[model samples]
Target: MNSVTKARYDGLADWYDDRFVTGAEPHQPGLLELLGEGSGPCLDIGCGTGRNFETIRASGREVVGLDYSSDQLRLARTRTDGPLMVGDAAALPFPDESFDTVMVMWVSTDVDDFGAVVREAARVLRPGGVFVEYGVHPCFNGPHVVYNEDGGRTAHPTYRQSGWHEPAPWWGEDGIRRQIGMSHVPLADYLNAFLTAGLTVQRFIEPEGPPVPHSLAVRATKPA
Candidate 1:
């Protein structure tokens, strides 16, 4: 992400905790189940309001929430007693193999360098440690589609296009674009990033079930 994007998040930081996050995220059930118990520290990458911290902690692990926005970190501090750090996900400020579990939730859509973030996750995770990803379903959730009046999505030609997207006719006021530009990564790229980083997939979960699942949660582990 660029300085512009960071500025946008900082601008929304004050209201962010309330405006966007109402409660525990939708993918929590699948995410927690896949991540399983952790005896050591679990890094929460792009951990906006630290909503996932409680769940990670519940699984017998120390939680560390990391985000690039300082304002987000300030809000997160109130939610999580765990250490909150202002850091970039692309170039995480930690040594290699520093965590027992590296968990990312609701992040890839906002950041431009998705691959770098995945690589960083793999780098920090110890061998046999899990990398759990919980976020928008890449296949169906992209800049190319919008939820229709019938509760289904209407596909836009721009679906295959990947990169930063400004809020437009397809996604205006009520969407994330109203806050900051979003990055649309294809499904292949999403999985390939983990594979290239030397992590092997253990489980792939879709929280929304069938007929257009809005979210996905995946668990992969670094080879021991």
Candidate 2:
């Protein structure tokens, strides 16, 4: 995990889910279904506000939500009675092969060295376990792209990582302004991270939603 990312998320922790997780967010249900209501521990990396913890518990599995933000974890503590730790994604505090499944949702694109975090995910999952994630689509989000005429539009090259990152501003109806900050990792860079972590790519999908065309979703596995 990048130190900068940790700082930003920590600042946004308390209100993170409120701003992002709504009924219509893409990939939440799809990722949950892939987990299959299993009977094992689930590790949610970057578990902002513990939004997924309830769903994980409803499936009869123990849940551990880890994030680097005290503010966010404070809110998460209120949502579910589970272990919430402040930890780095690149160097998780847990041992290898500890979880049956690991979830990295919307956090991959926010790291500096994504491969480090992916490697950590692989190290902590049991054999045959699944690692699933959803992140910004690198295709539309690539660098070298320029926002044309504003209002959620941009142009970019066909490559990833090298693409520019231009996040939109946040101004709530309460007349307060929230700053826009972001981190970028191209699509290919993300896929390679999983491979380097000794995980096998099972599936990748571009989830459909509004405000944008697609969000990338992936399911990978560690061989038993």
Candidate 3:
């Protein structure tokens, strides 16, 4: 994780937590469905403020949350007694094959290298272990796409421009991207991370919502 990203999250932890206190973000159901009832021990990368804790635990998985921001982890501590840590997603602090399931949620935009993070998630996963990714739909959601008042979207020429982007005027003043900035990964690059990590893609989902789907979910597994 980039130090700047870590600091940005740390500073916004309280605000972020309060913003999602109900944990009813529209995409949560899709994320949990894609996550399924996988066996534990599960590792939640970029587990911000424990938003997914209740649902994940309800599925009977023994979950461990990890994030790069200490302040975020501090708030997470309130949501679950399960272990939580401040660590880099690209370099997880665990032994190889240490987990039965590994998940990354809404984290791709925050990491410097999404592929490296996926590789690390694969590294810590046991054979046949599940890997889940649930986040913004790269093709339609990003700095390059502008959401209009008519519930339509406009794609800008910068859609192919991948990497860290400064906040643009189009971004909502109080939105996450405006607050911490974001990294863009083209649609192919987003899906290729799993294939590159040698995982079998089992399911791909574009959850139904809004005029254009704003979220995506994927489920994969390591070869047994």
Candidate 4:
């Protein structure tokens, strides 16, 4: 993750879910349903607040949640008493092929080298295991978007510029996303990360929206 993003999440970990994403898991249900019936361990990357624990647990796998933010894990423990690790997403502290599944939730926008994280995720999952990602639509949301104007509008900006974007008055909303900062990854660059990691993407979809997609879910599998 980016240094600025790491600090931002570290600071907002405590009340992040409550303030911004108060409802159930913000992403589509298909993400969890894709977790499969694997009896082996499953790893959840950037598992902020552990909100997805219930869905992962119901899949009947030994679930572990990993996050870079101590503040987030502190709050996560209250929600699910599961094994949680405090570490970077780019370089996960786990053995190669240690988990049967790896899932990253809404963390792609924050990581500096998302491809590194994807490779790490593929490294940890056993061959033939699955890796799931539930995130806001990369092409539609984040820095290039102006939510206050026209009830959420997208502006003209080069999509390939992926990195930390500071808050500006024109962006709208003094929300924590601005405080914590964001990294905008274009749609193609986002998919390329998975391909470079040797994870074959099987399913990808974005929920309905006019100007842009609100969120997206992707399912990939490590080669057997």
Worst 10 residues of 3 by lDDT: 20-29
Residues 1-224, model 1: lDDT tens digits: 34755787886776777766666364365766887877878899989877787788778888899988888888888877778888888889999999989998888788878888899899999998989989888877767668776668877777677777657676767557666767788888888888889999988988845477888888999999
Per-residue lDDT of 138 in model 3: 94
Put down candidate 4 lDDT per residue, 1-224, tens digits, no spaces. Answer: 54666677886765687775567554345665677677767799988888787778778877688988888888888867669888888888999999888999888778888788889999998988989988868767777666654666655474567776766665556565656777777888788989999998898877555555668888899999
Residue pairs of candidate 4 with colliding backbone atoms: none
Q: Tell me how candidate 3 scores on lDDT.
A: 0.86
Query: Sorted on TM-score, highest at the top, how do the candidates line up?
Result: 3, 1, 4, 2
Task: Quote the lDDT for 8 in model 4.
Answer: 78
The list of candidate 2 runs beyond 4 A from truth reads: 22-27, 141-153, 157-180
What does candidate 3's lDDT look like per residue over 80-163, in tens digits? 999999899989999999998898988878888999999999999999898998887898898878889988888888888888
Clashes of each: 0, 6, 0, 0
Model 3 segments more than 4 A misplaced? 21-27
Candidate 2 per-residue lDDT over residues 4-46, each given as its tens digit: 6656666665355666654534336466665666777889997
Q: TM-score for every candidate vs. truth?
A: 0.93, 0.81, 0.95, 0.90
Which residue runs of candidate 1 sit more than 4 Å off their true CA positions?
24-27, 209-211
Which pairs clash in the backbone of model 3? none
Candidate 4 residues lying further than 4 Å off, grouped into runs, are: 25-28, 148-152, 208-211
Give the candidates in order of lDDT, highest first.
3, 1, 4, 2
State the weakest 10-residue window (summed lDDT) of model 2.
169-178
